[model samples]
Target: MELTYLRTFREVAKWGSFTRAAEALGYAQSSITTQIQKLEESYGAVLVERFGRGMKLTIAGEALLQYANDIYRLHEESKEVVSKQSKGTLSIGTIETLAAFFLPPKLQAYRRDYPDVNVVIQPGNEPFIIDSVKEGALDVGIILDPPFSDPELHVNILREETMAIIASPDHRLGELSEVRVEDLESESLIMTEDGCTYRAMLLKVLKGNQVNYNLSYEFGNLEAIKQCVIYGLGIALLPRITVAEEIRKGQIVAVPFVHPECKFYTQLIYSKKKWQSKAFLGFVELIGGINHQNH
Candidate 1:
């Protein structure tokens, strides 16, 4: 079967619409239909069935999708191996904290060593990054510890991270050696947006202990949250790595929160079934080197 036809079929299966698949693949709608027809004729089986305006995968289609993923993955791998040089884009998805603080030095190292490899970093929260990695839109993802696990994903625990309640030096909480969730109930808080993994974890723990607090400000940007905390607007529970520089500069005091659940993790996530290119493997190796030095 033609690789082009299989690719078109995968896209159509993904979106459940031939028009959408055509639009995504930059093909005419007629081309998509013709490719699928040719593929079906070659295989002598119906791969997709139409119900009204949408399409659903038949058993054959479902099976083909599995093979299609493997076929495309190996095709890319073959190209990378034959090229013998890293000259393609590496798409990475991550949360803001890592993008802002942790990844810079590692990224700098990567750029210096592999100047020809283009790197693109997309920053978002855990769910967005995880979904993008699973969908093959991103080659890899750095995500906060998620509440649940997916068997299809290969997750490497980069580190167990410490999260603390931070405030400007003169803030009331700064005087305390350790703080409690109950103590935060009466305080205004600066935090990441609602769906953030760390935010959700903290909220879940607080709810379990019946500790309620006000979200004075919500920011998707870690720097903005840090700035708000530094200006004494409100206290924030943030990863220690993100605020290490500020703490060292005496701009903020990171008071360790007293809770078992305050511990978080950073993970490197990728699809288990996806074939890894040499450049992708190189990046993963770089990450390992960085992690080793950090510890």
Candidate 2:
């Protein structure tokens, strides 16, 4: 079996979808399928089976996955050992909010400490970030609370971030110290796109309380949402860390949420199965130091 086939199989199994594996690996979907077929042919056993729109690994596939991870980890370790004196680049992923506010200073510190090491940052939503980490496309991921649990991953809770309802300084709700869910029944809301943990939490609260409000707009970017609120387009519910500077500048006011569930944690996640390089370890330590100083 070619090593490339094993790599393709690993990505497909990690993502549980051939298309996702193709996208991550920058290969055609047919190429991914062909590689898996070759692997099955080489082993003379069915490795993957498709059911409905999703796919699952068969018993043989599951057994091989462990070996594949071991092989890949060993390969990475060998490279790291040879280059032990000079750790190379580290790829990191994070959500938009943290990318804008939380990561700059921490990343600055990391760059200052490791001037020779290169760093690449990719911004994505929680699911994409977690999957990228699991697939080994990213060395580390910083995300808001992941939606599901995976045994193959390690999660570190960096901090608990509280959500707030933000609006222009002169908006009707801006003067309130706190707003009940019912108070927003008729108000216009600007929200991030689906798959955001905080957005899901806010929706659950509104639905549970039977609050019917206007969703005036949905934005995929946090900065756009903030700008919309700054011009009095509509109020938004976002992590306080993201809007702190705006709140401090008096451009926006963060009204407290009476519902207690408006809080979630930020996490640093990585694959337990992947090899952790010296550069990765040092970068994680840098983030820890940043969090410590913040506290």
Candidate 3:
């Protein structure tokens, strides 16, 4: 029945380990166990259960968690409205490229306008970002992806960002003004993580053309990918904005490689069910200016 107990339960569910939840909440592991026990007593059902190496929610635990999420959301909303603090944390989840290149200016201005509000930036994959928003784990998200929509979240398109092929300035493919799919036959390729939208697009195009290629390198970090391309390890496909400065500095070249599927956009998203606090709206407005300017 206590709010803190529900919070502890949520944390336990989030971490899936009593020890981890305790560490994250700055409590003793025994305290975490006590809280989970208290929650089960209040609800009259067993909650979490062991799942191999970790823990998972029991059927009753899953049922309570859904309501727990709503309760937490509503309590935060009540605190914001009743107390009028004008202060809260805005947790934003974004992919690495947008975190580095697209959001800095907008987030800077957002901070200036809402000096009391704290911002937490979580760099992660697109699906994780979307899932976090839906779960009320993140206040908002910025991502570079193709036209996206979810019944649980509101999607706002920032702008269309063209995909480009990047390679060392002296790579053989750079000699051509435009690099066609066939032109890359048997060529080495540096790639981003497997599920990356741009990486998937590149592979789909090549497969459609039946162009055999080599996966010379696969990297989870953008800097590593760029460095590999710079060293002539292989050519890579990525959003153009990510390599604009490198191309300008002559560290890399953006080869023209256009495909319909390669066309993606920067987008802002938030859960439709979430209560928009004043700080949240302020941040959205700042990002809106970027959306307007880019049009």
Q: Against the hidden reference, what TM-scores do the models get?
A: 0.76, 0.76, 0.95
lDDT tens per residue, model 3, 1-295: 4899999999989989998999999999999899888888888899999998888999999998898999999999999999876698999999989989998998888878899998999988898899999999999999888889898878888889867788898888778887778888999999999768888888898999999999999999999999989888898988888999898899998977866666698999988787878888788877872234322
Residue pairs with clashing backbones, model 2: none
TM-score top scorer: 3
**Pairs in steric clash, model 3:** none
* Clash count of each predicted structure: 0, 0, 0
Comparing 2 and 3 on lDDT, the stronger one: 3
Per-residue alpha-carbon lDDT of model 2 for 209-264, expressed as tens digits?
99998999999988899999999999999888888889889899998776777657
* Model 1, span 25-143: residue lDDT tens: 99999999999999999889999999689999999999988788778778877888888878888999998888877799989998988898899998877878888788776789987
Q: What ranges in model 1 sit over 4 Å off?
A: 1-68, 146-149, 289-295
Q: Evaluate model 3: give its TM-score.
A: 0.95
lDDT of 2 at 105: 97
**What is the alpha-carbon lDDT of model 1 when measured against the actual structure?**
0.84
- Evaluate residue 71 in candidate 2 and report its C-alpha lDDT on the 0 to 100 scale: 84
Q: Among all windows of ten consecutive residues in candidate 2, which has the lowest summed lDDT?
A: 286-295
User: Candidate 3 — which residues are off by over 4 angstroms?
Assistant: 289-295
